[model samples]
Target: MARVPTDSPARRPFMTAVKVMLYAALLGLIGLAVAVSITYSQLPSYQTLTKTNDLGQTIRMRAANGQVLVSMGPSVGKWIPYDRIPQAMRSAMIAVEDKRFRSHIGVDPIGIARSAKVRLETGRFSQGGSTITQQLARNIFLTNSRTFGRKIKEAVVALALELKFSKNQILELYLNRVYFGGGAYGIDAASTRFFGHGAERLSLGEAAIIAGLVKAPSNYSPTADVEAARGRSSVVLQSMVNNGFVSADVAAGVSPAEVKIQKMTRQNNVRYFTDWALPQLDTLIDETSEPIDVWTTLDPTMQVAADQAIGRNTPGGAQGALVALDRDGAVRAMVGGRDYVDSIYNRSTQAQRQPGSAFKLFVYLAALESGMKPTDTLVDEPVTINGWSPRNSTRTNLGPVSLREAFARSINTISAKIGQQLGFSTIADMARRFGITGEISTYPSMVLGTSDVRLIDMTRAFASVSNRGVAVMPYGIRKVVSANGRVLYQHDAAEERVLVAPWVAAEMTDLLQSAVLTGTGRAAQIGRPVAGKTGTTSSNKDGWFIGFSSGITTGVWMGRDDARAIAGLQGGTAPARAFHDFMVKAVANRPVEQFETQVPMPDWQLEPGEEAWGAGDNAVEPVLDENGQPFDQDPYVYNPDATAPAPPDPNQQPPSQLPEVSVPPVRQQQPTDPSRRPAPAGSEPADDPSQSGADLAQ
Candidate 1:
């Protein structure tokens, strides 16, 4: 309490220390102000915001008839500008992403205080303190890494952004540039990718679900994981209600179904086709910024019919695939699997499966092209090549049968004998000529279909057979036009005559007709003159039916994805039945015309080898010159001295009494109604015989 005299030496030391402290504090304030000014100056000006990359418009796809199939792009969709965003959606986004979005300038001090309090009380960091403007600043200009330095930069950038632009403009940039999961980058893309429409059309539930994805896109991607997405959406709905964006009753009543997210990209039904066609897009044109409108040959009615037919006939837990092509080789309908979301593997064009007896069309064609006629004799018995003995699926062998009978019954021994006689290389060549690009085994067992091939290729080959032996290349797209109406690509659709022999084609048609009528493919008859073949693989693992009308050719395959045997399933059963049902619906509106007169005797019948046996057997009788002598005889007549390998006759028995065993064969049976079969299971079946082809080799 002693009074210090003026200019005392002891008090002077303390006064000097105080003056130094004041000068240091003044210099510190000036430095901090300069730093803040410099940080704000480094930010991009609002005038340059409009010029920044505005790349968020969806790539749209339309079907052949102008039906909008899908809209997708690199982080783009219907560009719903800030002015057009629905009021409900806008409110929902604000409530879920940043509740204090309207009140805060750039960063929300109140939100930060609450978040800090929660973290301290809970001993966990759960809440984010960034405002909508702060998020927009980070998203557009800064990386999303979490660190103190980065947060400081984010806060500075957010303040700078707020000072440069209006609140509305900041909100607009955030909504238009924020990532929302899937391939969606903005609210517009999120709206379209999830709801299949513009953001303006978003319902309350949809807006909440999309808004919920901002925190973690992958964790809430509707397509990648629907349940997780729904749970996140419920949180958003509650937030919306809490923030007064929606009523509590409305939030509680929101059903997940009302917030539909596209289960698959683009449209639902045509994803298989679109996925298959997407790669072809880049091949058709160089890199393009604008979307290209593609016109495909997919017949909507036929596609529906094919889908329904397979769904009706395939057995439980067994998958099936179908591909249909018109005579001109345009793919009319293709169903790769039951649900594309469950699996995207395109069985129609990607999966390779053993065709079973369906492959015999090539073997029989090889026989015909190798100078063997339907009237020629083929011994259906055990056939051995290089110590590999191939037996009939029926276990019994028919003594002597015509090529036509062997083909109709899908006689494996006879087919093996013919393949050995002509060599499997010839059969493989024939298959390749008919558009089967996959590898074909040249082994004798290959005559019984020991190789794998895709359904599309098989359908194309069969279409060739139906198209008068003019081999066809299956194609889907008919035209591709740019958004500006420029023709980027158009299918020439010119028929490439790969195998151009009318006589052989006619003969094969006659034989296949026998297969449909009084043969293994009896179930495929559509109350009209139809022809097809039924094939059941070893252990009943695979079943296939491939056939064609003069106008359309189709192929169907059934089997479990795990290659498990379908009990009592046979090619002549479910697959043939599906073919019948599909054809019945496909040709309903079209006229049922008889198969072209390419064959002289469309319904000619012969008893194995003895000659004629049916009503129209002699319709095109040989012309007789004088004295009833025959003229116009075929040059490749059967000769006793020919070096061709003899047909197998291991057990000569009557055709009816032949042991009908299953070994991937065309076993004939009067198929029951298709209604008794199980519903289709998966998308497609692949080829890997449950029992190896060596089972026959033994």
Candidate 2:
């Protein structure tokens, strides 16, 4: 070939190429310098990888005595210091990820060139060529996008990290802050999550397996794919031997199969209570960044008893809920459902079901407030209003009964009459004032609990009666403190007067006691002078029994979500049995206390044809009308043997010609309805008719 002249066309192109190459190299060096300076200037000051009391951490709940109830957070594991990490894990990680980890400043130029060559030849970017320091930089400060600008920035940031921190510091940060999959955030968490032990106690095989996970944690997780994880660990061991971290003999001898993986066992029933209390945390805690210790008012003993009670009495396929509160309205225990695992819906505070007769307490409270004495008498005959005729569960009338007796029998007619006399609006308003925020019907049947209300609200309302008329807002958290023992929040119960008069509550309590002693709630009596009411909804859908002693107020409910009537279930039966069992255990250690003495009052105002009677010679005189006969005692009577008496139809009788009569002394009588008799053990009635007298609530 002819020699080309240095200044010829071909020679000029070659010289141009050489000059271009040199200029490009110079420009690259200048760009790298600028990038390094910028990345170094942007680096953060030294900060520990593990944050203690970081408000950003998960919330923690504890009992009143400082026992941990639950810790709610993304990172639930403890932080382990760098020195505590095992040497085997460190060697395994360094060998598998970057053999030149200690020797390289931050970016490994030789490895980068090799990775770049491989990518070009294979048409794939499988080789990352990332040193431990570069990975630490990307994990803490950079994003994982494969772009020229990001890579440049990553290189610069990695250099900055290497300059600012020692190799050991960089490695320490890498192992302590990297994600190990399965919500395990650090080496300690990863060790425990995979091996069921601490990082400091990891074996050689365990260390190799964990180190293998760094490349692709989800795919290499031993818990998820054992064979794949073992294969990756085998690769890691070979890499360790190649890097001189371990001898080939030692690497070959190590077996990933021998690594014992632990199954996570976190069976906690308190999650239900914690979930219920979560909303309160935002208002109760202003600083959630640092770990806060919430001190709640849960009585562990009462909680256990409540759990066991529901489990024992609740039949299969039937769901139940229970709530217990102290005299001051502190929620001692709450069972939202039969099993929280099956469902997280908290029935106690969230579910709104018809309270049935349980809501009658508010009605009687209204009646008591209206000067209706418990001893006042009313006819339990069927009454109709606007065409809604409420019937007694017995389908027959109790000729005459005392207000106290009527309540004990849960006579549907009497409650409907009382609700009519008071007016539905009056009863609805009174129920609202008592903390029942659920929608209440204004119909006459409202007295029979036609409105749906939450169990917590009912418990709160009854607790107000137990608290001597002072309204109570149910609270679980007693106090909140920081991890460093600084007081963050404290509960100071605000005083409230829900009832108009304290005496009204006392009188109502007396009436409730009478119900428990000889009325529908007789099955709920625990022999220590108890008071409460029984409620059953229409169609036997829901049953409830709420009662309270001098110190604790409890409410129990049993039903199915499908609104299917549980076979043979009644408010005064299964629910009452649960209440008795729970209360028996809850108050076993507490001293028995007497209720406040109820002050006596004069007779209540009478309705039409109603009168007060005295047993002694001090009886009042009889009042007579223009005619010489007693009212409701006139000679004209409806004989059952004949067809039902036809009223001189309103259209036939002249208003002025209606017969006038004289009233005579009325005598007290026992209820003729057999269902009015107190229910015996195992003979409880359904909330629907034919169950029992108290079953008429709905």
Candidate 3:
């Protein structure tokens, strides 16, 4: 009877359907095997992963004062033995991430079914399909890709991990390798980054907050948002109550605010410094499967000063960067842009711009090295090299002026003449000697700093001058140590290369002094005999003030990122003022430093029949009496009988000149002190701003 009905109308269709189901089920099993085999083949070698550090590499950066700046990467936090792990942290982890973490082999089938049912009922997933073991497996051996293939691989690896390691071992790996917010990896790092302590010391509240972060670290990170983190913690607490990890009364007692989080000062603009420095590990050490602690030369105080200075002084819609270096070229402070949130591009080390008159340092150093004295007279006239005619910013032809006079006044004509005399190759070589490693154009215009240069490089070059001629290599990392306290790298303090002769540095410092004392950098004056130069490129596209005070060389650059000009912006204005503000605080604790050995710089006399070029925006010549004489002399001392000039115009601007033309400020007024005056003239007048305001560094 059974055989007769086997092929009947109803039975025939059922028999075919059973055959098809069998084939499909067989194919599905085969596909599952292939996926498992492929995932196992692609898995990283885990024999070395006996402990928390087996899978990740972390980098921890600190300031000179041992202040932890940032701890990032897979293994950033502390790694304690299994017994040392906090019970509260373990309870919180199990409560939120996988309540059945201890009982499940790897993937939690019941949890997945429950979550799927919730998703169907509520139109949203209330729990993740993956368990803690699956997450550990994915984080260790897979990517976060949400594709079905990745999910298959995740499950396969989770089973492998559960089979290979004990229940406690799997939990240890999962707890230590999970990602927390703010560059923290592992429960220890998350605890340290958020609570400023190791995971072993985490309280119930702190542990719960951290456990909640596993769902969406960035969205619920306390460091990223306050209310969002609190909200997420509330959810985690309810999860603990639901999972029976804690009673509802116990969960209710856990207040998010009761958990003390560390101050967030480390998350500021100093990230610019860390971002620049982290990549250096490639050269400093061999690849390792452990975290590293990098103690840097960053000075927290100086970093703050630099940030505030740039923020307060940078013009609206423009960006500014400041790099301060020790005399030996250790970077102390760096501000890459106006704000890190607005942009991550590090202008200090990445953006290359013309330094304008600041580039004159190379030409003059080359000149001095070639035996040309600061007192040597050079004609400030139209001179063309390779079809490039160099003109002063003031456009007033300063006939013949001494080297000191031309340099202090930022005389583009004389600087170009010096560049011509020494040859562009010679100037470029000098720049290289002083730590400018980038491509320097040897073109005639390059003599006037037409070639691009990084702000960090310029600051380092000037550091050589302040270091008394020793060459500088601007560096951030001072020491690197592994997690096991093995010394991986350390800065060489014995290496010192001379970039210039002491006499040459002294001579350059003398000219720089004249610039602040009598020329375009008067705004940088800080009630002391500081030396620096001001630079403004054509159309005021780039403004620079690189100077040395108390052995600290700071280079400041302010301009639009697109290289457009800011109206009324000059090196002597925003950049110089920022420099002043930074340096004043930077050197406040340090004793005043003077150029130890200065080459006797003469008050170079103007050539006969040629009057002194009036000071531009950079100078404050001594006020002279009612003589009403056209300013013709360098008055180093204040003149008693000079008229008390009216307060300068608030909107006073540097005399606008054509592009590529450099000039000394032609306006002369008494500078109660210069540059603080809007007219570029002061009560204790220098010469015309045409002489003082000259800038070809644009």
Candidate 4:
């Protein structure tokens, strides 16, 4: 047996140390190789800004005279030169984002070690060792996946960024790419959004507040929580002083008073207009793929006036929409809703509700075209046809009234009768021709506005009437310009003659004047001549007022979002009041002009078998027979003849009768009780048959 000699304990220790050193060296080589491979493969060879989609990114709305109403961008980031950035702002950013920004080469080894130790000790991700360049890399080129793979890629990209771009370039890109609260994406926009000023005008405290938002914008938003934002900003200021970026004395002496928050004058002020014009612009630009500038007829003064008017007049639960157009159909002012930020439903162009008696203007126009004069007599009686009976809004009839009286009174029965007599199809055609782009029901009830119409459509229709029956397509943009200031496209006014006769339109306008003077539309009357109609639906579900003056045609609609009736609101109240308020302020500086008056009716008289006829035979003839019923005779056969021969004389027939006839004494028929007669044969008995029979017997 042979015994093997065991190695000494000292020798064993030396060998173990050598083996440990070898393993460490090998591991270091492997890590170095992996790092090199990742840096080479993951780093982008070339980086560029995301291609701008002008349609989705930027929009411009202009006035008729080529003035900008709004300039909007989805990315609210604006680039500024490094020199323009305040020294204090740069220092604050450095102190909060990266303390060793100037000395680091895109990667801070010490920061990484400290962050790793803290992460391991805390057992949560409490620290990020990303340099400014690394943050820029993640924002520009990498996704916000927050995974180990993404972090590794970010590190590689950060190293590449340092190698490719200068420190100032990296800082500029980072500043421009960060997000701030309130839809602001960069320092420039944040400055403008919060302070109502540009980044270059930022003070030390203001800069600190903006820079502090970079970490958690919503949590530290000045608009959302001033106290939390101030605390965060103070931390940034202290950090700047600690890092020697700002003097300790300056940091200590600064008070909250030194940080002036510029008042937000129009918080989400342009939101309504932007929401309305965006879809239209998208449709126009995206459809043709043609760059076009829409020169709107928007007058900022009028828009503000309209917004304020609607805000003031609409009830707490109610929202209102308004649209104003020029005689040429150019939109001068628009308020889509009460607050666009709260709700995006554009009531002016999107909501559809019954226009009520505001639709009577079309009915009256049809009647006028059918030889019915505005002064002609019309019975405002309860009318029943085919089981459909319409009653007056007042629940009582005004017997033997003139057409103008019926219209001014907004008698539902008269309007319904007129609509039925003219044919619902004819009225629908007229409405369509007048630029009403809604589904119109061809029912007898449609005469009293039993259909829904958008405010924009109504505004265009009224504008057509104001433009002497020349219908102009309503448009917002007039011209589009490229990013480099090149004219891309321009919009031309499209006009068409929609009414049968200009005179007919003029008479209709005159009739509408009575609406403002004494009818339901009285609330819309301004000092100048104004023509308008008021509308209140069956259950008061909708309130609408549409009118026009010399300078603008305005339409207002008031209602609740849930289709519920607003308390005490009618077309003549809130909507009309809002319209008047806006119009008065909007046209305050414009010269007053009188509405065109209708021509006088000519002298004419009712002949045999003809109902009561007025002098204005040339204007409009009564289409009624001697029995006060709708004329059933063909218009071609009975062309109105002022001079017709009388029948032969009865005396000439007396020579033919030779025999004298003995006449029996005629018995006088006993007068029957007036209330005992039965009602007309086919007539459906009213709800109270006895009362109906009595009235008919009378």
User: What's the lDDT for candidate 2?
Assistant: 0.76
lDDT of 3 by residue, 107-187 (tens): 889988998899899998676789888998888767787788888778888876766677777777777777888778788
TM-score of each: 0.60, 0.60, 0.59, 0.55
Worst 10 residues of 2 by lDDT: 634-643
The CA lDDT of each predicted structure is: 0.73, 0.76, 0.76, 0.70
Sequence-dependent TM-score of model 1? 0.60
Q: What is the Å distance of residue 313 in model 4 from its true position?
A: 1.3
Relative to the unseen true structure, what is the C-alpha lDDT of residue 556 in candidate 4, on a scale of 0 to 100? 94
Clashing pairs in 1: 337-683, 338-683, 353-687, 393-661, 394-659, 394-660, 394-661, 396-659, 537-664
The positional error of residue 274 in candidate 1, measured at the CA in angstroms, is 2.1
Better of 3 and 4 by TM-score: 3
Model 4 Cα lDDT, one tens digit per residue, 395-478: 556566667656766777787688778798898888888878888888666776777888899888888777767776777666
Ten-residue stretch with the least lDDT total in model 4: 681-690
CA deviation > 4 Å runs, candidate 4: 1-68, 74-269, 282-295, 599-698
What is the C-alpha lDDT profile of model 2 across 343-382, one tens digit per residue?
A: 6678888888888878888888889899776657888786
Off by over 4 Å in 2: 1-55, 76-266, 600-676, 682-698
